[model samples]
Target: MRGLVTFEGGEGAGKTSQIRRLAQRLTEQGETVVLTREPGGSVGAELIRELILGGTGQFDPLAEALLFAAARADHVRKKIKPAIESGSIVLCDRFYDSTKAYQGAGSTVPAGVIAQLTQIAAGDSRPDITFILDIDPKIGIARAGRRNLASSVSADRFEIEGLEFHKRVREGFLAIAAAEPDRCVVIDASRDVDDVASQIWLALEAAKPRFMRNAPQIRLDPKTDALVDDFAQAMKAKLLASQVKYGCSDDWLVDDWEGECQAELANHVQKGDPRDVANYAAFCWGRGWRASPAA
Candidate 1:
């Protein structure tokens, strides 16, 4: 079973502090915990973070979204999957929801694009629970400013955004929590740190057992199901077209079709579920190809 928990909020919402406390608590309970944060989990992602937050270059909103998705793809493949497969409970500071809130909220990028990128990057994985720390933007900005004063370096690009932007970010978090109430639990961050942590712990307790029992599942609406089916059919057609175009069925099997179909199966089928694999193979065979001994 794989479990992921994420903490999200505007600046100065005590997300980092709460994550630390929770990590320690889980450790005490004999759970192997991996504490990580977005846009910095892997080497490639860390480089992207520097480009995003270092204030050195200008990035359009869509470009920024794409960069974020690229980073997430690398992070999930390198760090998140390995840790989860090792049976560690992963506590992430932020995840793709941050991108949706920050880049898709009011920017030029549409929410649909962000959602598609997140799905491709995450490959249907989702956090077991997400904590949204709600707080007044004015208070949060002031607190963040005070905290930044203690650091040696100047404020980064996002940190330099004015109060209005921060206010929008706060509103963005609330909107996200409302939209995904089942996955997101909103905590009043105006309360004391211990009180906020208690709220998060309660939310975790409610979600932990279910998360630890299964891999996270993605539920598709009709539109999304149609889109996925279209993608699969397109891929299949491309393989058949290549076979016809090249007039080489042997090369189709050796170099193209079988590998492509298997990759699709590996991606869409549940891991370690042999029944799904067999079913997928049968479906492919019924479509056209004769099953060989090797297949």
Candidate 2:
């Protein structure tokens, strides 16, 4: 896949407008842009989203997270993945981070649970650049209310969350961006739309070096996410078990799984330097893999 970018913010943070302007700007510069949104991007995901954002409120926090993950699995697997694979400039409205904020921080769900679930639903497909639009919830909620009035619909489940919830969501976004400075950039969403778009464009320009240096298909999955998740359900535990089964020390796998991998998988690996080969191997094992003699 090509480059992936996502816009994250509270409701009415001008993500829609900024995404549109950026898509148009990039298209004018002779790039193919595929603009999409989450929770309701693809057909299957949209259906799940109705149950989620519809007024029923039957879904609890954990259920909401699962539903979002299920929808995300479809959206990324069917829509976002294909666009990225085709080398299009893919811009997504919201991604996994929203769950971290809304469900994890704003409610009773755990962040680690959200992380693990995101892996199952999203695989390893992460954005090349993530722009978190920072804004106050008070102004944002009013804007969202106005938007709902114009659209002739009530505020959605997340949009209708109270002020404190939105504040926690904002702080969550900032924390994420701060934690992953290389992949995330925070911008003031309280600014004018044009001003916000300009910052986004500048950041896009700034990220070109790293983005262009990577492989063509940065994050497209070759197979189904279900196939990936079935194996990854107990991925960490499985890896620890593999250490005992294979007579490799925890320290050995922790420190040198990269050095232990087949050369082919080695060349294709992404993630941090000294990539966790044990984790990757666990991922492979989940997909019905076995250890090679060389490994």
Candidate 3:
């Protein structure tokens, strides 16, 4: 139903600002938008983000990469995956590409190592579209410096890196865009805010038919929310009963049934019809169950 869109670039490429604008525009268009950022989307990931960013040079290249992968694993499982499955357009400030660029290209970590770790962390969840805002490292770092000074905040680890390091980071992003042309859109980010936003919007509009148009029409009133909860519990109970009756002993499936059931509920809820919940009830409870005619 909904898709994940990520933004990536060097320091001060304005990924956060552009994400804000995109979320606002999408929300105004009646989309259910969940705005999140890498390294800190979930509670566990935020703690890891603080550890990684603040520790900075304390962690060696391999250790740092591992930390980032750990955080991403938590973020993807707890936040990003759920939002998209629930039919919310997820706009993330950064994602795995940043890891490859910063930890692989900008540091001593091997590209192969980064790729393997990214697979472990992100699994099958990848952005439907990625906007790579391109800018000169000199311009970006200067902008970052100015913003940090204005906000009375110290530069983060990546921002405080030397100009040459940032240049490597920029090259990394461009190379990614080159390799993954179908999923990556490189935008000129040296221009003013409005110009950058305009380009980003145009790209999103171009992608709408394929990526954004199929989201279920969610009429989420309080009653509907409650109905979702009720159906969820019913389906979970049914799943448990079926497993027991069939003498199934997949411990992992039993342990993680809540997530499985919720995913199924989300899939049904996004079937594009509001009355799909009524259908869901019948599906879960089988032949004996029927929706009221009014339902």
Evaluated with TM-score, which candidate comes out highest?
Answer: 3
What is the Å distance of residue 275 in model 3 from its true position? 18
As a TM-score, model 2 comes out at: 0.72
Whole-model alpha-carbon lDDT for candidate 3: 0.79
Q: Write one digit per residue (lDDT tens) for candidate 3, span 208-241.
A: 5455233344455786787776765566565455
Model 1 residue 129 CA deviation in Å: 0.3
Would you give me the overall lDDT of model 2? 0.76
Ranking by TM-score: 3, 2, 1
Candidate 1 regions with alpha-carbon error over 4 angstroms: 215-295
lDDT of 1 by residue, 1-295 (tens): 2578888988778889999999998898777899888877899999999989886438998999999899999999898888987778889989998888778763567988998999999886688889998888788877787888886556677666777777777788888988888999999998999999898888887665456244433344776776756655655555455446554434334443344454445443424343344445455564343434223
Using lDDT as the yardstick, the better of models 1 and 2 is 2
| Candidate 3 worst ten-residue window by lDDT | 286-295
- Leading candidate by lDDT: 3
Every model's TM-score: 0.71, 0.72, 0.72
Residue lDDT tens for model 2, 1-295:
1478999988889888899999888888777899888887899999988888886456789989999999999999899888876768789999999999888878879988999999999997889999998889999999999988999998887886789988989888988988999999899999888888899999887776455433332132767555555544455455445556664532323332333233323432322222243344544354343554325
